[model samples]
Target chain A: MDRTAPLPLALLRGTATVLPRAVISAITAALLRGLLKTHPRLLENLTRLEPAIVHVIASDLPYRFAITVGRAPITLTVVDRIATGADAQVSASVATLVDLLEGRIDSDTLFFRRDLRIAGNTAVVVGLRNVLDREELSIANELEALCGPLGGTARRLARALEVIADSAGARLAAMHRTLHPPGTEAQDLTADVRRCHEEIAALTARLGTLESRRKRQADKIA
Target chain B: MSIRYLELVCPAGTPSALRTAVEAGADTVYCGFRDCTNARNYPGLNFDFDELCAGVTYAHARDCKVLVAINTFPRAGDESPWHRAVDHAAAAGVDAVILADLGVLDYATRCHPNLRRHLSVQASAANAPSIQFYRDHFDVRRVVLPRVLSVEAVAELIAETGIETEVFAFGSVGPMSEGRCYLSSYLTGLSPTSEGACAPASHVAYEEIDGRVLSRLGGVTLNCFARGEPAAYPTPCKGRYVTHGQASYLFEEPVGLNAIEILPQLKGAGVTALKIEGRQRSRAYVAEVVTTFRRALDALERCDEGTPTGQLHGNTEGGKETCGAYQKGWR
Candidate 1:
């Protein structure tokens, strides 16, 4: 169990890359179609904006997706190669994108943090962001709908797996910290000096109180 | 003792929000279609045709009135959408269609003669002559008064026009005349009057620079909030700018119009309805505001004095509230 266990990046990349491009594209198209069906305003808004090519790239993986808007029935496609001249290009980690789809993180905050990169046509990007923010989107719910009767069971199993993975990761990090300490001598010394100063202050305050009490007794005796 | 309860007009951004307002004791709930015909033409907001129909049915079942806001000004060549929205609203059996444009009102008057029309606040018909013109020409039954008018002025207008008047009781206070502000359009090339969205979400962006959050509309910085301070809607009018080496809210400060404590004064001013103005907000917000106002109105009807003031501090913009023009004279 190592804290420096490299985030299983290879495993994630392998899983993403092994999936067929057609399958991924089909899934994305189907999910977006379902979203439009539930929320028709999304398509209507896209139609309002000028026609543009938006390329969405997963920064941590070799995956790129493009959506062409400015027409009725917006289209989504998976591009095998990076787009060279997209009207707007949005790049983020797959996890961040998932969080966005789930409405778990604020897109503006991500953009501000530079975790979500947008280039080229900013108006289109802003339009897309606004449209997306107007609704509560959940990819898991769409997938569950596709699964029918087994959806509940699948969701429960997924939750259990997530819990197990989180606990396992936390335990591994704790063990790693025990093996390799923070090793900051200066910080420790600073803490010690701070404690000593606090003690001295307290003792001086106590001495003042004692002197006041002794002066009262002396005054009474005189 | 029989007391007339002030009609509580609330905003419903979605179907659920409409239902929430009704359940929370809204006398009337106003909403718009999912297009530029309404002032709150934000994405994923407002109702579609089916949703609007269902909402009307739902509100009717609950004995609550549904007002459809087709409040935006029609574009030069494209008046079809606004006309269709009025037709749809009438076809859906709404109690009233709130309108701002002159041409749209004429169309509504001619095509749907039986339908009720209310002049939208966007019309900014502050004076008696302007309001009388709408009532005389288009047969507008009600006029949602602009926030610019004082309570006394509102009472005077109502007395002069003898038409039903609705004043803003809660929500963002706009300094400029409604339906005429071009600040957003100047920066974004989209007209607030035509697009029905001021500071259209498509043109708004927020960035954190040196621990300060800067809210921009189409590349122009509108407002900057220090860390841990509450942020407001990114409208150009409420932006803080540098003037004479001092950065201050030049046009207007961010404060919500709250007439909760002055409910009696507004009711006394002969206001037919008190409008709560947050259609783009969530149902939770709708529920909270509607519920608080419902209680205050109930208490007022019971002849109780001293309405609560700080009940809505948390919900207000920048966590501050003011009676706005209603009490501006006192200051």
Candidate 2:
């Protein structure tokens, strides 16, 4: 057996490139939905905990994924959609995760060598690694080799699935609105410092008001 | 009683404290760089590159080991500085580099296989599997347990993994999981877990209204204290809040974790080291805390179970301290 065989391009690009952000985002939602469908224990844990905020900052991608878990059970909120600054994030490609899951590459060594980093919910991340790191997935890699690249029709079909599951585009727009609110002083140092002082003063005044109210309430209760 | 040789791990936020802790009898001293690469990335606290080398030398001469904590999670697409920190810590001949991020751990393992690795409390590797996972992969030597566990739980963990464990003994106690908190980022657009400061002085607001004090962080009111009340720092999780139309401390009350009383139980639990948690503190505070722990450890070593001790009650936040989850069921 060729244990050192190269990975299928589909396994490689499917996660990072072939699947558009919208599609991958949708698939993430669907995959999570599927997991919740069968795993009663996990569902109970999540429900008891209300939800877990996932802050996925992919090191190989030009975006960050942030989602409020309590509100949307099946939504992927992608933020900073486009790569702008030199410090823009890059998410791990599908190929890399597949290679990692298949034991073809050591995830720790790769990450240490500056090859991988999947941030957010380190514990849940351990669960995700467990799900993907299956011997069966390695066998599927060979099957993927035979299936070649998905044709245009198949890509369109996958895109349609993505469109149905992914609420990323709308969420991205909302995040932009909140992050770059108009009229807030931009990153100008002078303006930011002044704004900072004003914010501090405002908070101080608010604290005083709350203190008076709390004291009055305590007095009345006593 | 079977003797437990508990190692007194102390903080040396500055070079002076490094020397002070060693002279005062600290078994190991942990410090960090003068940047956000470490959790204690306070201004004027951490060591400069040259100072780090010198501090390591200073501690080594006194038979004390120095550990560099580069514990913050790296920013997206900008991991060069964290990598450089690990490389520098290794090159400086420090005893170990305490790390949290898996990427940093991976880098350190491959780049400096000879460099010792200790799990930062920030990883929150509370369970046996997580600890074993790190040990199996990164070959981590020790893990600093989060403040959430009880002494019994700590004992169970030590029994399960047989891995050296460090638990926080004193300092400002964080309510939420370290390195995983996002409340500040959600409210203030800055995070302590990532930014190395919480309710950062930049966003915090303090105002006196009608002789009462109110504290706010990122526009969210944390607490309102009367004139005589001691005002706690306005962190998001530890602050007072309005929930279900009721105004109170929803997540946690205003207090800090003080496990100084549970020193014996911690030793009994097979914990190899006891960490003192303050890095953004004054050198005076470091001296007092380190000296107290050093003496207590010595007494415990001598099996003087009824040893008289000096009081550090005034040094604790809220002027009081609890054994945290070690004794009481804190859920």
Candidate 1 local lDDT, A131-191, one digit each (tens):
5655556666765566679967766665566667778889999999899877778789999
Indicate the docking level reached by candidate 1: incorrect
**CAPRI rating of model 2:** incorrect
| Count of clashes in candidate 1 | 0
DockQ, cand. 2: 0.01
Lowest lDDT sum, 10 consecutive residues, model 1 chain B, at B307-316
Model 2: per-residue Cα lDDT over A69-170, one tens digit each: 333353445566442322112246555655654545433233222344433233343333322321223434333333347433444454455564455667
For B250-293, candidate 1 gives per-residue lDDT tens digits of 88887878989888888888889999998876665677789999
Q: Tell me the deviation in Å of residue A98 in model 1.
A: 12
Query: TM-scores, in order shown?
Result: 0.67, 0.58
Badly placed stretches (over 4 Å) of model 2 are A1-222, B1-4, B244-246
Q: Point to the candidate with the largest DockQ.
A: 1
